[model samples]
Target: MGNIKKKKMIFLIMLFIAIFMIILAIISPLLISHDPLVTDFENVLQKPCSEYPFGTDQVGRCIYSRVIYGARVSLGTTFLLLSIVFISGLIIGTIAGMSGGIIDTIIMRIADAVLSFPDIVFAIAIVGILGPGMKNTLLALSVIWWTKYARLTRVLVMAVKDKEYIHAATMIGASNIKIITHYIFPNIISPLIVQLALDIGGMMLALAGLSFLGLGVQPPTPEWGNMLNEGRSYIQTAPWLLIYPGAAIFIVVAVFNTLGDSVRNLLDPKHI
Candidate 1:
């Protein structure tokens, strides 16, 4: 249908954007024309010009350079966070679902307790208690986030555990580990891929929010959220400070969300 074609086209465009962003992030240091951390008070708050495509910030740091460098921090942190959450969740969920009984009850209960609270609020509390820093924020978010993966993985495993194919594998003397890695993972990976794509944007926003609140990557680090926090004061005089970084976040998040939607549609059984 026309609708599906349009959707696929949008997905391809967004996918290109996403890949470009990642490439930029990887080569940010080489791409930056100015030293992101170094300040040039002489040219402070200069508007966009031939020398500075995105202009200078309040402290005369190159906004373009900072934004580019910030991409590294934001994307790296999101990828690390996702890896931690996904692996921990997958392992715990697999154990619970495979073992069942009291182990499942205890793990589910713990996850339930964590999930009951608003995620941002809980993250704030944890970071506040541990003192505001990037490491603490990463640790807190990782601890909270793994539960979502665990729950999903547990359900997926349970759904496939009793399948006739799985039973046949068991009867043929295949090891539990082998069955899981070879059979279970392949069957459930489509949903996991969809979840990963969906979470990428959310994790990015979560890190940005924490930084905006002064609890994430500290200032002078060239993080987008920290840039936004610094740029907030000059919205009237130097809107470029906010505009550039904000637009970066918006574009990246939109690209990721588009990818997530595309993945979900492709994986959805009804669509197939």
Candidate 2:
């Protein structure tokens, strides 16, 4: 009972933080007091003050505004990447799991080939080929990230396809599509949701890392990663430049990760 209460408390706290971040991301534009990109070279590297709550960067861009706007970019890209990966993985994994033999072999082999490469390395290669930009970065990430979801979904589908209800559905002449969608899909959702939550956090970190390395969101954009990259040189002179955006990334990622773990614990029968 004590453990359960602790878990519940943790869950509520993490959930609240996650929701707050989402809301912040959604309404950041209205909250921003200055133009994130507009620079005031004369007032460069100003310390935190009422005019610029988070201070100013090397080029005098408002760190607070940029950090706020950066939330949108970071969350937006993460959502887009997640959506593409989830849908493609679901479809491919479902098909491969349902259709055994050559189809399954082919699909799994392709997934394996992609998975063989280190994720960051593969993403960098793709981004390098496509040229560095937000769109290309997302595309690169989506291409590499889908393999995990596909493999997880495939494994889950395979494990559940032979269940009694699935057999019953097959015996009743249910269409393959209907069986997979209505029967198999629903059963696998718990684990998928857990994976989705965890992956969102992971993707946030990946996107930030990419941006920090100058392979993701280009200059003048108010992305946390790009902001971090720009702030690196001014770390000693303008620590706030690094702190605000770095803290933002850290908080968002930690929130998702904590929430994901809570959800996984709650959903796992072994934990119960």
- Candidate of highest lDDT: 1
Summarize candidate 1's per-residue lDDT along 1-272 as a digit string, tens digits. 88788767877887888999999999999999999999999999999998999999988999999999999999999999999999999999999889899999999999999999999999999999999889999999998999999999999999999999999999999999999999999998888888988899999999999999999999879999999999999999999999999999998998898888887777776654
Displacement of residue 81 (Cα, Å) in model 2 is: 1.0
Task: Give a tens-digit lDDT track for model 2, residues 1-272.
Answer: 88877887888889898888899999999999999989899989999999999999999999999999999999999988999999999888888888879999999999999989999999999999989998999899888878888888989999999999999999999998899889998899998888898788899999999999999999898999999999999889899999999999998888899998988777776665
lDDT of 1: 0.93
Q: Give per-model TM-scores.
A: 0.96, 0.96
What is the C-alpha local distance difference test score of each model? 0.93, 0.91
TM-score between candidate 1 and the true structure? 0.96
**Candidate 2 regions with alpha-carbon error over 4 angstroms:** none
Cα error, candidate 1, residue 195 (Å): 1.2
Candidate 2 minimal-lDDT segment of 10 residues: 263-272
